[model samples]
Target: MDVRLFKQVRAACNASTEKVADGLVGTIVEIGGDPLTVRKAKDRLSAVLQKARNGVPQLVGGPKKGEEMAVVISVRDLAELVVAARQQETLGEALDAIGFKPYRGAHILVGQSRKRERLKRSGDAPSAATAN
Candidate 1:
């Protein structure tokens, strides 16, 4: 497995501990196996992650005055999720927790983070307001 990916797993493990006390919920997972499993998991993980990214949204029409905007979970968030489901139970449980669409193997199809897009006004943004 790539070193960076391993680091990500470690980070996920840490976050999981914070989120649920137990490092990883469910049965104790192995998180390790033959090179093929690691490779496949990583590949599937990447594809699933890419499909979750948001490209600036509809720039053509610009954002609606007050419409909700789509937001993709960060790579790190996905990593945390994947690590929580490691080698024991299937990733389905983790994916389901996060609202990912059903997928084969350890892969999951995640949705955007999505939230209301507040209108921006001159000198009225939160950052500006906080500068008091």
Candidate 2:
């Protein structure tokens, strides 16, 4: 509906995670049965976006749904989710493939997994203890 508002919502969702990680924010205590923490973070973002759609003030919710509990997410979680959804493609392409025709002139944030930080396995790199 409100394209500009949607952009704000997306940015807010991404920022919410940093706040949580820094102990500056909290999330709703009532878990929605999603064991995966990543999903939980995404859900929180979704809730925030939903509230925005409903005319509720974005970030109005609290960490525990106290009147308005905003979701807590991390940069890693959001990036991973975006990558999984778009997979080296842009948001428009992904939407087109999924048959989601957005509102004319609506601008969706293009998701592109251009780079990633790889986790080195124990055997992949020699530690000081392992090195002579």
- Misplaced by over 4 Å in model 1 are 1-23, 27-36, 51-132
TM-score between candidate 1 and the true structure = 0.16
Model 2 clash tally, residue pairs: 9
What Cα-based lDDT does every candidate model obtain?
0.40, 0.44
Clashing residue pairs found in predicted model 1: 71-113, 71-114
Which regions of candidate 2 deviate over 4 angstroms? 1-66, 88-95, 98-132
Tens digits of per-residue lDDT for model 1, 1-132: 223334444445326444432322211122221112333435566543453353111101113465322223456645655664463344765565567875468767699987988888976766855777
Predicted candidate 2 versus true structure: per-residue lDDT over 1-132, tens digit per residue: 223323333334335665533332222222222222444546676775554344333332333433434443444444544545344246765575668965798587988877878889978998898788
Worst 10 residues of 1 by lDDT: 54-63
Worst 10 residues of 2 by lDDT: 26-35
lDDT of 2 at 74: 42
